[model samples]
Target: MAEVEEIKNLETNKCKQNKRKPWDDGPCLDRWEIEKFDPSWNPSGMLEVGSFSRAYPKRREKHLLKCWPRVKSALEEHGVSCELNVVGRYMSVSKTKMTRDPDIIVKARDLLRLLARSVPARQALKILEDDMAYDIINIRRMVVGSKEDFLIRKIRFLGHNSSSLKALETSTNCFIRMQGNTVAAMGSFRGLKRLRIIVGTCFRHDIKCVLWMS
Candidate 1:
């Protein structure tokens, strides 16, 4: 009887040891449910805004109005909210609840800046891509000459029938635009680097000489 009682107790112990704990199954949680339990798991609710002042808002007002709908829709697809202040001549981008990627706001800002710089909406949208980037180089500061000299240098940069500019674009694989005193370019990092060097050379040396070296 004693032996039987001991065997029964041992069997009970084995049963208890083999039983699974509630935690052993892990938390069967949906995404939101998991976020609810872990505060760090959720993205911040704070709003982020990026604002830009366009250089020629009045001149492009009509075109901007026409393209605003498309731009807004594109931004919406990325969980960004955009607003155009026509009177203020500025555009603003803000993060919304749906925004999860932190880099999206920066990309949205670049898109607006490119549009403001007179880049076509179709081309400007390229900024939203991960591998694309844009830069606005202030050529006004690079010129060390009088207004006439500056004009002459600008003309040289454009070349006869813009052939020089076209060649630079082809060689560097970048799109370049001369807007007033600034030069805006969009391309990959390597392309942009070559563009900056070539543009700086245009201001420093004769375009013909730069072309020969290239």
Candidate 2:
């Protein structure tokens, strides 16, 4: 009986060891199988490695010690003269043109804010790409508005999944962020015009009217 009990205990311990071997309960690997990596046979297939270096030339009047690639691209595309320069511990910005203009300065600050926050840099820069001249307005700026006007009923992904959001962006030329139950959109005059039409037709009862006044 004693011998049988000892054998049972050994078997239980062996089973526990087998179960724990595969689990990552420890910091280091006890055993590893290193096979020769073949890109062709890889499930993901030779993925491209990412780099932190800037591909564009850093020669411009404006200097920002560091800026995201998307931010720099948007600035260059919009004819905003700027460059990046590394200061002691911060990025120093130098702008040759439109430095004194309040509107341009405001837009620049907004752009930086969006990029620095949780928003993706590419999505944030969409505000800079506009076919029509439009004033940028924040939702907080409008203190007075109808409840119907402020409230938006979001039709989740329209028909498809998240690509619908991208479709809306392409169609309306807007940068849209989905909040808890509604969507926050940023666009130019023309883009907003299209978006308003979309809301009226698609959303129907949610929006009574769309109006913008300078």
Candidate 3:
């Protein structure tokens, strides 16, 4: 009985020692052979879509038509597709069957948004690059006064001949456009950060003061 018990203990220890961890398992067959039999591994047909709308698309129709071909071709090079709906005043981008990089769709979306904000198509294409960024700062709610007061602030923000505006752009290395009540800016990340600070100071203090400091 003692010998049998010792044998049993040895067998249990051996079993524990022989037990393989999940990470210890090796592939039994080639990766291609295994994937070939996987019914749920198909990713080629998956689609992702991004849509955009603007307040005034009619005004941009001609511009869009002129740039759409180039935009479509550019996106196609990255395995994405784009479409413009003149009647609906919207643009849409989607991943095609050839799309391998998931982040390309997001870049395409940003491209459409920049274009919708009246950014020149040539400049807007820069959003497709890795280090480019953009921001839309709403100045309408930044003031605490009437419309006239806001207008005054906006005027101050853009000095005579837009000298103050150009100075801000130069100091920050950003391209800025004042569209309605929002300021659209695009550049490198560092430039955009500096731009936000300059815009805040322009609205909070005097544009002349900010320009002088810069």
Top candidate on lDDT is: 1
Query: What is the per-residue lDDT of model 1 for residues 136-163, given as tens digits with 9 covering 90 to 100?
Result: 9998787887888888888888888998
lDDT of each: 0.74, 0.43, 0.73
The predicted structure with the larger TM-score, 1 or 2, is: 1
Which digits, one per residue and each the tens of the lDDT, describe model 2 over residues 145-190?
A: 4545444334333434556567777777776665433445676666
Please state the error at residue 109 of candidate 3 in Å: 0.9
Better of 2 and 3 by TM-score: 3
Per-residue lDDT of model 3, residues 30-137, tens digit only: 222211123134456446544433333678889998998999888888778778888777888887776755666788888888898888899898887666788989
lDDT of 2: 0.43
In model 2, residue pairs whose N, Cα or C atoms come closer than 3 Å (at least 3 residues apart or on different chains), thus clashing, are: 62-83, 62-94, 63-83, 63-93, 63-94, 64-84, 65-85, 65-91, 65-92
Candidate 2 is scored at a TM of: 0.36
**Candidate 3 regions off by >4 Å?**
1-56, 206-212
